[model samples]
Target: MRYLSVLLLSLLPLLAQAVEVGERLAPWTLLDQFDQAYSLDDQTRTLLVARGMDGAKLVKEALQDRPKGYLEARHTVFVADIQRMPALIAKMFAIPAMRDYNYRVLLDRDARVATRYAGAEDKVLWLQLDNGRLVAQQEYATAAALREALEKAPH
Candidate 1:
């Protein structure tokens, strides 16, 4: 019983992670490094939410180059697949400082599924971004796809 209790306690926080695929997640609830809240409404122009480190890295690199009409300045959100093998992911996070790079780790229990959302394995993904009044929607092949699209979008 004691062992079961300890195990349950350890797993409780993991189970409580709020990220969900295809489910509408509020911008306000997403926690940043300091545990502060950022909402979609807070984004003045573009909001980039990538599922994996590669995607975020590429997008950040592209942003650094300052693509035309698409201001490099934007809200960047990163979601990590936390439920997978711990060592592999731990190394991934350790090598690159996610927080220092202006990226926020997404709290998702299903890392594999979240990877799919980040457009991992070359599969296309549908991203739903709610911009206060009008709903902005787009499909992305990879991180660059949506970044390019948002750069050209009127709103």
Candidate 2:
């Protein structure tokens, strides 16, 4: 399958999902909703991927309240280019399920960190934070559909 190879190749460099969770997430700066810069690194205490969907919101809410339950809920990663995902990102964020959880839409900015973190084009990837360390990684596509699939996965 030529397409499959192309797709896998596209995801190669973005696959560095190791030790990023509790391993002091490398400092990354992104502009949040208020048009302000947000940075997360070793000094940070919390990092949330404010997903923009009711279903995802629910998961985030659960994680915030019943962190154990929420973390226990098996979830995977979804990735997409910022250009093709504004609506989906908005929809994913507007859900009451994630009322308190905050997230920044991963953008295709010109920076080495994101470039090394994400990969060619935009990709969806998941990280499993175990006791503050990233122990797992998963990537499906550049959209929410893949995240849905990961939610149902056996993990």
Best by TM-score: 1
- Candidate 1, position 97, lDDT: 56
Stretches of model 2 off by over 4 angstroms after superposition: 1-23, 41-103, 106-108, 118-122, 130-132, 142-145, 149-155
Work out candidate 1's RMSD over C-alphas: 7.7
TM-scores of the candidates are: 0.44, 0.37
CA-lDDT, candidates in order: 0.46, 0.39
Candidate 1 TM-score versus the reference: 0.44
With candidate 1 superimposed using the best TM-score fit, by how many Å does residue 17's alpha carbon deviate from the native? 17
Task: Show the lowest summed lDDT stretch of 10 residues, model 1.
Answer: 116-125
Count of steric clashes across candidates, in order: 2, 16
> Looking at model 2, which ten-residue stretch has the lowest summed lDDT?
75-84
Clashes of 1: 2
Off by over 4 Å in 1: 1-28, 39-47, 65-81, 85-96, 103-136, 142-144, 153-155
What lDDT tens digits, residue by residue, belong to model 2 across residues 58-147?
333333333332322443221112332355654565323223434333332233344434322323345444433555555433335543
- Cα lDDT tens digits, model 1, 1-155, are 99999999987645654444434544444444444554445353434444544544555564555543343244434444434437666557642454554445444444433533334433323344444322343435554665576566444
